[model samples]
Target: MPDYKAPLRDVRFLIDEVFDFAGGYQALGATDASPDMVSAILEEGAKFCEQVLAPLNRSGDEEGCHFDNGVVTTPKGFKEAYAQYVEGGWNGVSADPEYGGQGLPPSLGLLVSEMIGASNCSWGMYPGLTRGAMAAIHAHGTAEQKNAYLPRMTAGTWTGTMCLTEPHCGTDLGIIKTRAVPNADGSYAISGTKIFISAGEHDMSENIIHLVLAKLPDAPAGTKGISLFIVPKFTLDAAGEAGARNAVSCGSIEHKMGIKASATCVMNFDGATGYLIGEANKGLACMFTMMNHARLGTGMQGLCLGETSYQGAVKYARDRLQMRALTGPKAPDKPADPIIVHPDVRRMLLTMKAFNEGNRALAYFTAQLLDVEHLAESAEEREQAANLLAFLTPICKAFMTETGLEATNLGMQVFGGHGFIREWGMEQLVRDCRIAPIYEGTNGIQALDLLGRKVLGSQGKLLMGFTKLVHKLCQEHAEHPQLKAQVAQLAALNKQWGELTQKVGMAAMKNPDEVGAAAVDYLMFSGYITLGYFWLRMALVAQQKLEAGNGEADFYQAKLATADFYFARLLPRAAAHKAAVEAGGESLMRLSAEQFAL
Candidate 1:
């Protein structure tokens, strides 16, 4: 079995050394998030994840979720763990205090979430969706709606889901067949089938609040007609408690390759009782409040699974006796040296390490922006944070997942044949990670959103929000003694990023297909440069700490080493993405639709 240990050291290094979460919280006047409180939360949260959830990962995957009739049952030990989760006051760590939350900063909440997710991705899904649902309702729900749902959901007794995907549509919400008919009581009858609903129907929570999207009778056609509705599994009575069974039912659950314990259900809403949360025909925009959160969380899935795989693989490599090193046998007494002595194995391990640590830096940096966006007192600070968040979100969701997939695959490779076995647990990480790139909007969709909607949609304004930071950092540290070369490399890459975007923009103006063709590559290119920026930041921090003679010498040294590996071995991949972006859409489109057929 893979022993999943919390990477608290790394988490702290980023929170304390890299991004300085402590100082930021102080700046935001988050009195409860003192350094001691932060440490206590990290330690306690790690204990819950490592002890409560980690042990259930393999067993849960083996047991999966059970579906009988219209009900769904999560894997064994999940409910108890969930109860412990709520009792421990973890459900609303960063929620509004008005709704029973601790009112902690967003980054702290995200750090806690990382520990939970890294421990058990499947178990995390239940509460994870609840978080997205909570965000949606909190943002769009009226006062009554908040009073009706927020407390219980925040307490973790009630879970929530966003039911958007239908049998015929996934990304295109405009063509959805779901309908909302008005009733006398001011409620609407939501009748539609929603497929791939994560946490849609589960026994873990008392009620499942589904934020469904449907078109009203007088609504306009296409996406503009869509309206958001709150359809609960169990409707509330006058007392606002879960009372009677609603019309929603779990038709079935998916048996999948990964995250089998998570119930991905096919839901049938036969005129389910639903209340409008936002203005009519504005559902898509409101739902984005949840979608963006999910996208970021989904990106964390990649990091979470990759962390699990890397942990498992590292242990296996160090302990598992393999062929002697090519140069010399490091373990002279043993039959063969440990695989860690081998170059190829080291390469695989380093790649996993580089991506995992680099991605963590990116995530924590984004979390810092999230904190500013939510808690900053100044309007200017909030606006800049929002812009940067808007720009980096797609990159976070897409880039992290893409590289996370690579990390997990590399981790599996390091284990060789043992990695393929079920009991070893390496394969499960890969399976769980496979979905990150596909769901929460596919990386391709994220690419288009980055290049098409966010970049072009904002006319380069959003892109500049982030690049300006990169330029300023490069200019300030032009002679970064230890990382002068890295600084120059990043500066050049930052310049090329804007140049390539401009080229694509020019081409897209002439032929719109240019944007489509360049999008995925452009996003990848953007991810590499973005990650490069974080890696540089980390490297600089490590250098400063080393110069200042801070303790934990080995840890800081490893950070420097990994930063070096990223710059030398990984960052160059950005060039290929740039070349693909420059290749244009003609070569891709010249082939006729008939040529696609075998």
Candidate 2:
């Protein structure tokens, strides 16, 4: 297994050069997050992840988490590493200052999160889920609730989880049978079983705060009846410290294909005391606040795993000698040429490179939007940022993860037979990444959300808003000699994206199933073009640096080369998706459920 290293250069490139995040921070009134401060934070974050988390990754996978008699024990070193993470105040990097947080921009937190996730995804889960829970409480919880939970949670002395899935329900929360009965003390008694709860019962924290979803009595049926509740594993005393154990207990932990170190538990709530969050019958909306946060984090998991796998693949390719380069002997002194000398190996490496870098840009861009949404001074600015976020969230979640899976598999393929073995740790990445596309809402559901709700539901306004940005970029660089061709490509795609949406919208209006059929393909198409815009932006910047004779010539040149490879090799795949979107729903629906079998 290769040592996991954070791609600090690429991260800094996106934040400092491509995105102008420093200027963004100043504009957003995040004065504390000056460029120096941000850089320091990133450097410190990199150290913690590299030194503490990376070493635990394989050991965590091998040992997994232990669950016996409702007690959950994390893999070796996890508790101590988490302690260091807490002591460093990593968990509350972006939480509200009133709750003992650093009060930095969420984007800065996301930057650090990407590094931690890449080093050890399983170990990251404990705090990752906590952040999601914090978002929910911050967004929807009452002031008293926030005071009771946020401080300790933000301190990382306590961890949190979102409990929504039941034994019979996953995505369809409308039919959830969990009951939240109103108690005499105004608290609710939550009773039912929640399944697939990540970090649900870990022993690394003083308490586990669960934001549970249950239906209140006399509430409307289906999703409309659902209400959110704060159910802690241990009931808190009047002093706001963990007290008696709650009725909630881990029934069992799942034996999973990967991420075995992260406990996926079946939680049984037997009249667990829970405080209602938000208004009754509006729990789904509140849950989405956390869900969206989790979705973006989940998307980054794709990039994280892909990056780790890419690092391993690149090292192996450079060291593992097989045959001579097609052109000539690149490593003449060796027994044979290194595999990295081969064109196919280079192709695989570049493919992984393009996706990893492109996805990083997308993630960071979305993070900027999040900063704007939360901290923008004006209502219009906030609303505009929110609209764009709504439009891109599904795309980022689905496309990045879908492509992330491809990138990880490519990493394995680059390793050939050795990749399949567990010792190499390449297969671990493949196994771990498999669940990303499935969880946090399946990619299929994300596609439908993108095409059906966000795109057409808004009458193409959301789609237009993003294309307008792309259009502006093209317009700005249209006259540049070096960037003209790339700008032209983006302009063409910008126009085509609008046209494609219009076509899909028109078809779906007549036959709604058309949206379902074209959804995934349309999303992939959008993703490719979306990435194309970022690649061009990066290339334009790299070209400027080169023209100025920047000292980091290799870095800028590589950026330009990767952008060229993306445009020449990867971006063209959008055409196939365009064709598939135009194929309509007939072929998909014609095959009935019975025809799916052999």
Estimate the TM-score for candidate 2.
Answer: 0.99
**Per-residue C-alpha lDDT of model 2 across residues 1-598, encoded as one tens digit per residue:** 6599889999988898889999999999999998888989989999999999999999999999998899999999999999999999999899999999999999999998999999999998999999999999999999999999999999999999999999899999999999999999999999999999999998899999999999998989898999999999889998989999999999999999988999999999999999999999999899999999999999999999999999999999999999888899998899899899898999999999999999999999999999999999999999999999999999889999998999999999999999999899999998889999999899999999999999888998999899999999899889989778778877998899999988988897799899999999999999999999889889988999899986799999999899988988998899999999998989889877988994
Could you tell me which 10 consecutive residues in candidate 2 have the lowest summed lDDT? 481-490
lDDT for 129 (candidate 1): 93
The models' CA-based lDDT, in order, is 0.92, 0.93
lDDT of 1 at 412: 87
Off by over 4 Å in 2: none
Lowest-scoring 10 consecutive residues by lDDT in candidate 1? 106-115
Tens-digit lDDT track of model 1 for 6-108 = 8999998999988888899999999899999999999999999999999999999999999999879998999999999989989899999999999999888
Candidate 1 wrongly placed segments (more than 4 Å): none
Which one wins on lDDT?
2
